[model samples]
Target: MKEKATLIVVGTPTKILDSYEKQHAPFTKYKFHLSKVYKGDGEEGTEIELLQDGNKDASYNVHPLMEVGEKYILFLERSSTGALIMVGGPAAKYKYNKEEKVFESIDGGRIDEHLERK
Candidate 1:
């Protein structure tokens, strides 16, 4: 999964910026504030827009969506339109557990164990 990702970062989802249809599928744009850059070109404290594959109203959208203010470790790739997207859908998103100081899989996908720590 890491091999396929163009960008890998730890960040918090700040807001849902927009929702729109692309190529007949629903897409959502999110405002993400970067806290760390494990792999890729992003700088800490930078805010980047991430595109997800579904909107809030899409019934068939099975990918786990990022909640506002929740911290996450994201594995992303660039879309053809030059937007960043999760590399493996829900599998690429891991929510940070502040109390436990660990990363929990949002959809049962296992990421590198080493990445679970700061």
Candidate 2:
């Protein structure tokens, strides 16, 4: 099934917690500082967290670690608590290629193609 994404933005990751030593918890998390608003109400420079970790075997849906200072286009949804987060695991995250002026999917293409009607 296709997951619904309500928000889309270009932002930079401020921090990440994939190991137990960092967040003091078992789940992996990413904190992003929004830079560009694309499809949601996220304000520029505001921070949001993306959480999606459970156990060692649950890595299939996990988002890869984002590099600090690297801008990315994020497809997101609001959680019940009203926090912004990745809408469909790795499928919702894309890296912004500054020189190319395009959002490159983690799987190596533009997300627009997959999102459009065929």
Q: Cα lDDT of all candidates, in order?
A: 0.82, 0.64
lDDT per residue as tens, model 1, 29-83 = 9999999888889999999999887888762445766789998889999988898
Per-candidate count of clashing residue pairs (backbone under 3 Å): 0, 0
Model 1 residue runs over 4 Å out of place are 59-61, 110-113, 116-118
Check candidate 1 and list the clashing pairs: none
Question: Which TM-score value belongs to model 2?
Answer: 0.65
The alpha-carbon deviation from the true structure for residue 115 of candidate 2, after best TM-score superposition, in angstroms, is 10
Q: What is the lDDT of candidate 1?
A: 0.82
Question: Candidate 2: where are CA atoms >4 Å away?
Answer: 1-3, 17-26, 52-63, 80-83, 111-118
Q: Mind giving the per-residue lDDT tens digits that candidate 2 earns over 8-101?
A: 7777878774533324434456788887776666788798777644424334434555567887777788778675657766777777776666
